[model samples]
Target chain A: MGIQNTLEGSNTEIPEIGALDVDKIKQDFPILQRKVYGKPLVFLDNAASTQKPLQVIETIQQYYTAENANIHRGVYYLSELATQKYEHSREIVRRFLNARSLKEIVFTYGTTDGINLVAHAFGRKFIKEGDEIIISEMEHHSNIVPWQILCEETGARLRVIPMNDNGELDLDQFRNLINSRTKLVAVVYVSNSLGTVNPIKEIIQSAHEHDIPVLVDGAQAVSHYRIDVQELGCDFFVFSGHKIFGPTGVGVLYAREEILETMNPFRGGGDMIKSVTFERTIYNDLPYRFEAGTPNIAGVIGLGTALEYVENIGYEWIGAHETEVLQYGMNVLSEIKQIRFIGTAQKKAGVISFVVDGVHPHDIGTFLDREGVAIRTGHHCTQPVMDHFNVPATSRASIAMYNKKEDFDALVRGLHKIIKVFS
Target chain B: MDELRELYQEIILDHNKNPKNFGELPDANHSSEGYNPLCGDRIKVFLKVKDGLVEDIKFTGSGCAISRASASVMTTLVKGKTVQEAEELFKRFHDLVTQSPQAEVNLEELDKLAVFAGVREFPSRIKCASLAWHTLIAALKEKQEPISTE
Candidate 1:
């Protein structure tokens, strides 16, 4: 089970009409061709990590097989080629987020890494005792724990904005939590557990009014639709490449050029510094200062391909197709009398968390696996969400572009079998 | 179907529905919590030891079928035995589940617990199946901190 994060979540709601050629798109992912337990795999765990396309898979294969060299510091022809490919991916990410410059787009291992980078660099420089950091209750452990550690080490305290019954955050509570000592507002763009798309623009506007920076944990929302950092005006945005059908290791941390320039380097390493003497060391420019050591060269390149793959297909159709599938899934699952859906937010993407009556999510997971249906069952690294809901665990079926109505049918069938067997 | 049935046997299901000794022992001298972080299953084991023998035992908290049943049956078996015998039983059960399927170690000597023999087939569920036993050890050992099966 994957337990992961943000938004450049702007105004793209599920429109009344748009569609993707999902059958054709499914062919692009080679793993979809295989079967598990003599049954065709109905993958519904996209929120955990997406199945990579052939385009991404081959790009990685091509990189290791032919173009393998350390980037940023190279003189030879092969090294130069590798550096260009690496930097080219950064430019691709910049365009994807519509960030002003490449200086703002820092390559990270994943969303967790990016969040930690901000926590360590920004927290050290700016946050001190009695200062406050505000986060919502529904944050993935990545977003919560880093701030918690920052609070613990720096003597700064953390404040939480609570969510209501429908799994939507109380904006009133969020606004109240913001006051004079509030250094930053860190919130997820889309909840990985609840699939609630946050009103990040409003949150950003509120925080900007107070001159407090906001970090949108966009790990879940990036692939759902297009994300424009400039449009959202968020100070920092972070997302994992793997969550969007790219390689696992690469992610993007889009700090606004001004904010990126303010923080110190997260880690000290070779490429992160411009020059180093015995007495002193000078760190590299804007994003590179944050990107220490040798980056995930192949992963970055593969993420570039994944982004291009999404671009070629178009986000409008992807959003509409996902909305339809999720709606159909909710409709069919609601018909089951025993099923109690968790995260019933009006706006959701790529996740359905639920618990069946007289059946534990763990058993449901085991039974589903036998039928070759893949779903996640656990806290999903959101213990607060589970605690607030008062369930030990939940069965989650998350979606991606490759999924269809048949996947929902298959899940409903597997659930029915579980009920029958238990009964 | 065979594996699924074997895993969720009638006895296991029955125990899961009506777990034995499922409560806290208010008079207990020793107690410890066992946590399966994977599923967020937590069970607190409370033992009343009198003159080196486990006079009474009970568990309180929640978990899945295999774990709940295992804890239920374990209380029934360990109630009358000495702490030494309980430890031996833990070793035997651990061997039964952790050993490769090809390695035949007979569980005929143990009752009800043999239902957990199927757990070795599903590697992920093995931790779920054994969390109670680990907690039992911690309780007997007088460990203060909660034990975690990470």
Candidate 2:
């Protein structure tokens, strides 16, 4: 009936799902059982937002029940416990991203908040009129609009790195765009719309040659592939915890220590200030400087648990499994007539975008959902990329480690129904 | 999957395939551009309003089926209606589209429009269905030239 139900012969064992227990993995997510029009749910919208696992959900509940108090200020037992766990979460994120220092990590709301932070703090301080901020045509609106806002405010110019027909970034255009006037290069590490894994390390290195800082939007990249901030050498890296099977409203902004110290604090409030008076306020150091309010305490703890879950699974093995699924999905979908796939870059995560002849994407999504399969059918938050590809929208099927061959089969079957209906 | 035919009605598919009034009105008296940055829906509403009446209405855009079909249904309903009557219809349509709790209307003429009532069940698609309605409202507001929703 579905991919997960049919994939039972694999020898590999998932942590709790048993021997190739794709069904067990599906069982861990409660929402999978949800009936949309009285049928099982087949969620293929991981690129938009991932469904939380049981461990991540239980950790959030356990946090509110066992440890719930104001962090950093209170000296009471609960507060101290909360503060320790909160800071420990920072350490966990630091380890997750392989950052050199815990002080480099600052918690924000999500990718949008993280980008705004860099814009407000970094753009306000260093970026001047006529300076250039380079970005890709394939970037999500979160990456594009913030830089536009920055440029509008500071009188800076925004430079775009164009994409080729394959939805891959034109590195030559990027190279040509990077002049001495370029102040920043903000690129999405893995495009949410195209699923193109950008050559960010090379992009960062090239920017560094001209002494410009790069901010990698790792919102889509973090869960798909392993990240080493030190290895990538990006100055500012941002990602949402929700994208990695954790809670929403909590994200990380990983900036190099020196670069972070150079920028001013985004918001001045209680935990972020060193000493406050009616007249003047001294700011706190490093990460605290950026984290202003009573941070999402439970959210931070839950994110910590999420990172732990990812680490336990081992990113390498997860990547391998997802690659297998991606390949299988691409191969299967390619065989379907009138199904034209977009974003055929050699290097990609588990994202497949396509448009079928004579069928609207919404019609396809509706038909698929009737059969308990869910997929995203829209511009996927990157209109400029869609414009580049000369299409208005596409149906996106993004997979995760839990997605097996049977899921691909189910999608193929759904597409077959869609084609028949359209014909 | 056969049940999906309920949502993607033949009328809607027909309209989406051969959209009504799908062209630019070069002699339009009122025009307005609408954009939904969330889903990247871009639409330009062109109205030939004269003597306080809508002589003709047209739209041009590339969006999901809900948006295109809704726009198609909207133009057909509003053509030849007075500006005042169209405005009232817009109010009624807005309430219907949003599935307002106090919605009170008969859907005899709004048959294709009634199909969009299912859009209310999907909150995300509500905007797609309403994009052209808002653009028409904008066109009514501008009443001359073209206004950008930037």
Question: Could you give candidate 1's per-residue lDDT for residues A1-423 as a string of tens digits?
Answer: 011001111211222223457888898889999999999999998999999988888878878877788987779866877777777788888889998898999999999999999999888899999999999989999999999999999999999999997899999988898899999999998998899998899999999999999999999998897999999999999999999999998899999888778886798988889999999999888778887889899999889888888887888889998999999999999999999988988888888999998888999999899999999999999999999999989999999999999999999999998898777
- Candidate 1 docking band: medium
After superposing candidate 1, which stretches have Cα over 4 Å from the reference? A1-19, B143-150
- Score residue A353 of candidate 1 by CA lDDT: 91
Give the number of the best model, judged by DockQ.
1
Error of 2 at A309 (Å): 0.5
Error of 2 at A238 (Å): 1.1
The best candidate by TM-score is: 1
Q: Over the stretch B1-112, how does candidate 2's per-residue lDDT look in tens digits?
A: 3334545677777787889999888778899999987656789999988898899889998777778888999999999999898888788777776775345546796654
- Across all candidates, the chain A TM-score values are 0.95, 0.94
Correct interface contacts retained, every candidate: 0.74, 0.44
Tell me the tens digit of each residue's lDDT in model 2 across A1-423.
Answer: 122233222212225423444576677678877887786677788988888877788777766777788999888888877777778788889888999998999999999999999999999999999999999998999999988998998899999998888888889889999888999999999988778998889999999999999999999998988899999999999999898888999999999999998897898788999999899999998889999989899899778878887787777778888998899999999999798988989899979999998876766777787788889988888888888888878999998767788888989998997787667
